[model samples]
Structure formats: structure tokens, C-alpha cells
Target chain A: MTPSSFVKLDGVAKRWNGQLGVEGISLDIPEGSFTALLGPSGCGKSTTLRLLAGLELPDEGTISIDGKDVTTSAASDRNLSMVFQSYALFPHLSVAENVVFGLKVRRVSKKERQVKLHRALEITGLLGYERRKPGELSGGQRQRVALARAIVAGQRLCLMDEPLSNLDAKLRNAVRKDIKKLQRDLGITVVYVTHDQTEAMSMADTVVLMKDGHIQQIGSPDDLYSRPNNTFVAEFVGAPPMALIDATAFASVFDNSATVGIRAENIQIVPSGQGRLRCVVTESEFLGAETLIGLDHAGASGLCVLKPGLAMVAEGSEIDIDFQDESLHVFDADGQRLTG
Target chain B: MSAHANLERRRQAIYGWLLLSPAAVLLTLFAFYPSIATLWSSLFSRGTRRRPSEFVGGENYTDLFADPTFWLVVKNNLLYAGVTIPVSIFIALSMALWANSKISARGFVRTAYFTPTVLPMIAAANLWLFFYTPGLGVLDQIGSVFGLPSVNWLGQPETALWAIIIVTIWKEAGFFMIFYLAALQTIPEDLKEAADIEGASRWTYTRRIVLPLLMPTTLFIAVNAIINSVKLIDHLFILTKGGPSDASKLILYYIWEMAFAFFDAPSAAAMTIMVIAVLGVVAAVQFFYLDRRTHYQ
Candidate 1:
């Protein structure tokens, strides 16, 4: 382990009722980095977060924080804090009380606790809302209160499970930027869990994609987006989803009967003869700045091309869609990456 | 022009009133009538022992004020409420926390703690009366084992009320535990986990997080325990019967003695009105205290 390794999960596995919940997962979270555990529901992403939080004991392997074995440590001894998705504030307490609850529990002096509570409230932009109950706050405000509570604990490591999932889309976007900026500014090591791929792609320094209790891939967001090691990562990381085509038809493009993947933005709809592949535009989605065209290729099949918003392609228009050979992604029969 | 629509509207109105009238009448008959009657009765006076049935306006209230026994019973009620409310709620909270802990045989333990709630108070009082017997009783036997004095619990004026209070706490703590358990379960596991991660010890969590979160339930159970302490009289029947110089007799038991033992109906009615007045004040205090705190959810 490196000296900067903040949290390290070494060969961790968990089982319940003779069923595997997380199996042989290993990763190192560097200090002061914002990492995201990204996967579909039931993919054990939340389970991995819970394991790191000491909410669940691993049935095998070991977990450590800053090189200390914490597998057997109680959650109270972990020196970490978590913000739940539900924003579980004490309903009976005022906002100030909720934020200072941890300090009070640790028997900190009331004077120091008040100082820390004020600082946390200022940081979370909840300074004047301290007198109100949680029931009186909006969902976004409640989330801020939850964040304030976590911030007041002063623990170096913070775990968040879908913290912004409960907010409206507009609020989610705002809080997302706020959280990312806060994480970067505070230099606190944060491990966030989310099923929203966009949330992971937009906020993470390192993204660990999980599937069925196993670590599918662990890399920087740019690395996973630009050079996915498997078909699952390729399919999971991008929006409008990576259009998949059977590579067997394009014999010159690949040497095997593999699945070829290309991001929607990579494919271009060009005039015929300017491109190597020809297709008919079946449908089009006109986003504000770009238009996505769905194309039906003769053999490769189900190709989509993203074009500038000004491109006006009528229905049933014959268009040639193309990408550079280097931009092609090839995967074998089992969805394992063959070529980047 | 729309006869059927008119009939339907009429049907809905009739059904609404039909559904409402039963409760309205029951409340008026059982809840409202006695209250109004008690208030009316308080305005009357107690007659002489020979006639015992004359009316002089507000004279009974004045006589009640002059009677030292009335003030003593009021003091006893306050003591009972003070002791039982805090003790029962504390014991219930502790039991609920224990029953909800990650211990072995939690279900069996919960059932055992809750068993007293379902047992009749009269039966429990009878059983305790046997245990509080002077000699050859289980309590005295245990006291002898501990090398304690063989003092009669209910036969002494000093200890009689406390003995009854102890029995009341035992009888009602389990009943209140069920409310506390429900509230405890409603507290999401995440808050507990959050407190744990904050380096809070178990006692700190109980005192800061768990107890504060359970405030509404505490208020609820406190009100219930207070009401039950005021009204319940099985202990008065079995162990003390207002004996040892009437030190253990509650206001309701005193009213029962005045009405039946001495056959003084008007004075019993007057005392009954006084008890209701005291209870009304306590109920109002609870209502306002809880009203300010009710979250409505």
C-alpha cells in the first residue's frame, strides 16, 4: 500500500444466507480523491459502500484504512462518516441540533461544538436555516442539512449513497456541482455511490464499475470513457448508449465475429461516397445543440450517428455514416474487450 | 330534471351523517356529559351528617379547600404522577432499547417484557399483595436472605404509598414499552449508523440521538402513564385499601369509600368532581405540551 492510500479493500468478499453479495473485490482509494462506485441496481455497489462503512462485515478477506486493519472494528471506531440517500436527519431536532449531534455525542465542549457547527452550516450554505425542523425544509435543503451533518463530524473520509438521487432534476444539477466543488475544495477523500451514470461520469476522479458482486473495472473516468476494457464498461459509461454492431459483416474492420462498439458522438452522418458505410435514417432526435440520427445498416445493423443541431435530415433520407477505423471497439463473444 | 342525481346527493348526505352520528353521540354521552355534570356538581355544597343531601353554591369547593385530607390526596396524586411517569418511561425506554438490540432470542425477550402489558392489573395486584405479605411471603423471604429488616410494606404509612407506586410502575412500564418499541423501530437504521460513524458510544447515542428522536413517543407514553396512575385502583383494593391511616388510598379509592363504605353519596360526588378537576388539569397540561411538539406526520 502507498503512503497516500486512504482506504484499501483487499480481496474483500461478503456472503449472506449462502449467497454471495460481494466477491473478491479489491481497490485502493487515494487520499483526497472523489471516487464513485457506479453500477446498476443489485450490482453490489451499495454493498461495497456499506462494507467500507463497516455496516457489514466481509465474510472473507480484509479491509484497511490508512494501513490499519478495520475489518473487525466497530463502525464507531472507523473514524468516518456517511450521508444516507434518505437524508436521515433526526426529525425531532432543529437543524443546528442535527448538525452538532455528532460533536455532542463525542463529548466535545459546547463552545467548540458551536464553532464547528457554525462552520459546517456556513460551508453547506445552511447558516440561517438552523432554527427550523427538517420537516420544514425542502428536499434539496434537507440534503444540505444531511451534508452539513456529515461535514460537522470532521472525519477525513465521507461516504455518500445516492445523496442527490432524491432531488428534482434542476436541484440535482445544482447540488451536483456544489458537492463536486465542495469535495474538491475540502480535499476530503469521498466515496460516492450512484446508479446514474452521468453522476459518476461528471463527478468522479476514479470510477469503479461493479457488476454482480465483482469489480468489473476500476479506472479514472476519462480512462473508462475513452478506453473501456470490456463491453459492459463501454455500454455503461456513455449517454445515448454506445451503439453496438456485429463486426462479422464488416470483415475488413475486424478479424473475428465480435461485437463492435462506437459512442454516438463518434459516428458521423456524411454524404454518400464520402463515407465507407451507407445507411437510411429511420428516425432522428433533435437535441438543442446536436441531433442524433438512427440508421439501419444493411449488415452491421442498428447504427446511430450524432450530428450538429443544424443538420436537418428528413425521414427516410439515405445517409452514409462513418467512423475512423481507429475509433472502433471490438469485443469477443463473451463481451470481453478485444480491441480498444 | 335530474331526479337520480338529486337522490344520489341526498344519499351521500344521509350516509355521511349516519357514519358520524354514532361517534358524536358516544362522545357526548360518555365523554362530554360527565365532564359537564362534574363541573355542575362542584358548585354544590356538602350537607350535615344527618341530612347529607342539601345544596349550597360553591360551599363544597370551599369545604374541600379547608379539608386537609383533600390537600394530602392531591399531594399524593402529584407524587404518584411524578414518580410513575419518569420511572415508567425510563424503564420502558431501556427495555425497548434492549429488546431491539442485536441480542440472541430477541423475539422471546420482547414477548417476556410485553407479557405484563396483556396481564390484568387486578390479577397482577393480587399476586404482588401475596408477595408483600408480612412473613412467609416471597418478599420477606428475599429480604431475610439479604439480611434486611422484616418491615411490613403496606402496614407502614411511610412506605405504603411507595410500595403501591412500585407495583404501578411494574404493571405499566411493559405496556408503555410497546409504544416505545414501535417508535424505536421507526428510527431508520441510517441515523444509527451515522451516529456510530461519528465515534459515539452506545450511551451517547441513546442519550443524544435515540432519546431525542423518541420525544414524541415519550410524551405520548408519559401522558398515558399519568392517566393510568390517576385512574387505576387495583393496588388500593388488594394491598392497602387506604389503610395505614389512608396513606396509600388514591383519590378514586377515597371516593369509592366515601360513596359505599360511609354511604355519603353527595360528598362522594363532590370528591369525584374534585378528582376530575385535578385530572382535567393534568390532561390539559399534556395536551398543550404535546400540541406544540406534534409534527403531524
Candidate 2:
């Protein structure tokens, strides 16, 4: 009911056979914003995207697009376009034909279809490659073709399901930036599904973190990383993910918290006698711009700190590390954030 | 190139030829030799009790061209092919779609549709004969229930060839369905999901996406169907025996009658050569024209 809400799902749930695929899901996507449903595999992120695309029907609750209930509408009737994980370009069709497939299906006039196809292909940087079939294109080119196909439909909302997963690491990074820029330029609502946190963090205006068919947190990337609502979100949102420490291990530092979380970058290594927690350096890895120091203390393993430049501490050397007080995240017994 | 590398290359060539020798030998003996021998023999006259075999030099071919029975059988075979190929393919596609769907008793339905494929051609022909037998046949019995006259399904020239065409389609469609089913399964489920989201109707998806994707399979099945139309004469033997005044006499059955029943070897050889030439033209058209339109990937 919010003024900004364009696409809304109210208590939506879907089941495959007798088992639940996604349940009790509610979300409001603001118009023209890039949103990401992010989770590990089997986390119901894809099922949610398919439900929104109208490829799968929800068993409960209602889905409304622009104030119109479309819970029972056919996928074609919903007027939404999607790019699949496999690209799913018609192998028999040329890239140009693939892009204009939706227009042809809708009986759009030839002149309009050609205009849209040209614009889409030009935007996706696939202008001259339009004559080539999908089988002839490389992975990144095929992905762009899928993107061109989705955008050519001129639908207000577009869904993408791991569209860059098929590309190489270098191509993935390039295409990720292309997609982010394209979304901004086109001003279309995008619901992207990704298991990779980096993709979600880099591309989304609002990242919806999911686990086991339920949303753990929904916020901006910075909000998710700095102020995670639960242990799951805290552990999921960042690279060298935030580590959860037993509260009892640091009794003096934590009084009532069940779990304490700290980012690797926030742990400062100082002289052994000046710090609160002391541990022996176990391993050190030299990454190009930063070095990561791994530490183990008393039976609990897992303290990794990122130090700028080459800082190598010899193995078995005792070191003292102090947690930055502002960066410490405390959680209650129920795994929810314990706010002051 | 160095001498050692050159020797190794020669060795590899010999090894490759050695590996291919068995297939080459079988093809030469069974296919190439028979084809050339048929053509060569068609140029000679059949030996008789008083006259020894003599060089005919196109006489047999000229007689074959002038023969009414030969032309009639050729016409019948062409009709059989024109009717069977497309109809069987369409039915096979439908059967594949049904078998691939999430219908109840899906396993049983697939097995039932595929059952005729494993049945012997003669056995299938005999079974259909029982169904087409005038008054006692299943079809006539069903018709009689509606008080419709007991029609002669295979006993009259008007309906005999059509009855043969129907039975051939039934026998071969299930076999063709297996190929179509395999092709259908290979299509990524994501394509269908993508089509759905792209706002394509089911008919549009099948026509534009599914059918185009299936072209390679259709081409493959068409080649098989064409060959079967010429070679599968077991049904003709059991059902009509090219009877009702040769109304359903295909080229292969006519060749058999000419060669064995009437002992006209030279004429039969000429007819066989003609059939081979027709098949060659079909293969050429498939490889050159249809293959260009088929998307292999």
C-alpha cells in the first residue's frame, strides 16, 4: 500500500507437489529500482523469481503488479520479460530474430519490431552480431543476446536468473557492470536472482538476503554489511564473511550477548601485551593489495584480518588483536541482532 | 618434415585405413556390389530354355518404362510415400507430446505408444488384417453397432491402398515417436520457462521455438521414413499380397513378384535400379536442401 510500491507480493507461497518451494514471502519492489534476491543454492531465490515471472503459480496469497492482481494470470498475460541462466536463446534463430521474438508473438508491426530490435541490440553492444545464431556466439555474446531479447520486449519489469553465471570470471565482471549500467539507463525495474553476494552487493539498490525459503534481511548493500539484522545476514553479506565468535570465549568483552560478530578488517593487530585477546599467527596469505592473517585461539578457529600492504608475521608468533568496539555486532540467543 | 615424422604419418594413415576396413568391406559387399550388379544385369536379357543370355543394351529399361504394371506400382509407391511420411510424422509428434507431458499414467501411456515399434512388421500386418476383415473385423463390428453397412476395408480397390497406408502409418509412427521423444527431452526446460515469461502463447512457443528446434530430428526421422516406405513390404505380403488387382502394389513387392513369382530377373533388375535412383535423388535433396534449413546445434 506504500506510494512507492510498484510490484507487491502479499503472503505469497508456492509448493511443488506437496513440498513447499517458497512460503510466507512478502515483498514490495519500488519502481525503477534494481533488486536482488540473493541466497545460496536451494534457498528458494530462483523459485521466487519464477513465481514473479508467472512461470510458476503461487499456492497462497496474491501478487499484484502496478495495482493489478496477477496471481492467476498466464505468464504471457503478465507482460514481463526474463533472461534465463542458460541464456535460452533460440538456437535456430539469429540474434536479431531472438531479440524480436516477443514482439512477433504479440503481433507487433514489422516497423516497430525492427526499431526496438535495433535499439536493444545497440544497447547490448550486439549490433553487428545480429545475423549470427546462438550456437555461433561465445558465452558472453550469448548473454548479451539474452539481455537484448529481454530489453527488446519493452516490458516495464524484467527478471534475470543468474544470467552471468555461464561466463568466465573476467567476462562476468564486465557483463555485471554492463547490466548495472543498462538498468540505470533504461530505468526499468529489475528483479535479479543470484547466489553470489558480490553480484548482489555490486548491482542491487536493495538486496534481499534469503535462506531456507525465508527473507533474512532486506536493505541497501551498505545497510546489509554494516547493520545486518541477524547472524545469517551478518555471515552472508561480505567477502571474508563476518565471523561469529562464542560470547563465553570473550567473557570480559561481552556481558549478555549470546554471539559476537566482527569483520576481518575491524580486527587490529597490535603488540602482544597491549591487546585484550592474544593469539599465535597460524597462516598468512599475500594477496596483491592486502595480506590476510589467519589466527587460532584456544580451541576456536577463525580470526582472519586484512592488513594493508605486505605484513607477514612468522608462523607460531604470538600476536595480540583488539576488536574495534563500533564494529562489534552482538546477537541474542535467538540469532536476532541485539540493538542497544 | 623429418623422415621419422613422415614415417609416423604414413603409419597413422595405414592404421586409420585398417580401422575402417571392416565397415568398408561390408558396405562394398552388401550395398555397392548389389547396386552395381543390378544395374549391369538390367542391361542383359534373361536366359531361356532355348536361347542363351544375350546383351540387351537398354532393352530391359525400355520395356520397364513402357510397362503399365511398372508405372502403376511406381504411382502407388509415390502415393504411399506422399501420404505416409507427413501423416506419420504428425502423429508421431503428437504421440511424443502426449508421452512427454505430465499426464496421469504417463509411463503406461508411453509404453503403449511405443509397443508397436517393437512388434514384428509381419505380426503387426496380421493384427491389422484381423481388424480390416469385412464383417467380422473390429472396425466393421463397431460400424454395425451404429447400423452402418459392413464395408469391405481391404477387399476393394477403392479402399485397399488407403487401408494399407493407414496400417503402415500406425506401425511406423510409434517408432518415429521414440526419436521425437528423445529430441523433446533434450530441449532445455529453461527455454519453455523463458517463452512463458516472454509472453508467448503455448501455440506460439511450439510453432516458433519447439518446432524449429526439432527440425534436425524431423530431418533424421524423414530419412528413416523414406527408406522404410520402400523397404517395408512385409505388411504388403501378409495384408493384401499386392492384391485387389494390384491396387496396393508398391515397387518392392512388384519387384519381388517379377523376380521370383514370374521369374523375370532382367525386368526386376531394371525396376530395382530405378528404385535405387529414386532413393539417391531423395538422399541428395535431403542432404543439400533440407539440411541447410536444419539447425544442428
Model 2 scores what on Cα lDDT? 0.90
Instruction: Give the Å shift of residue A126 in candidate 1.
Output: 2.3
- B158-242, model 1: which lDDT tens digit per residue? 9999999998888888888999899889888877777777777778878777786788888788778877877888768888887
For model 1, what is the alpha-carbon lDDT of residue B237?
88
Off by over 4 Å in 1: A1-4, A107-115, A249-252, A268-284, A294-303, A310-324, B1-25, B42-53, B62-79, B129-163, B238-240, B244-247, B289-297
Q: TM-score per model for chain B alone?
A: 0.87, 0.97
- State how far residue B280 of model 1 sits from its true place (Å): 2.1
Per-residue lDDT for A1-340 in model 2, tens only? 5648889998889888888688889999998999999999998999998888888889998999878899999888887889999998888889999898888878999999989999999999998997999889999999999999999978889999999888999999999999999999999999999999999999999999998888888899999999999988988879888878777776445657888888999999887688867787889999979999888777333677889989887999898888876788889888899874
- Which runs in model 2 stand beyond 4 Å of their true positions? A1-3, A299-301, B1-5
Q: Is the docking of candidate 1 incorrect, acceptable, medium or high quality?
A: medium
Report clash pairs, candidate 1. none
For residues A193-302, what per-residue lDDT tens digits would candidate 1 score against the true structure?
99998999899999999999988899988888888888888878887767677775554557664788888777876667887677777888888798878888766544
Say which docking band candidate 2 falls in. high
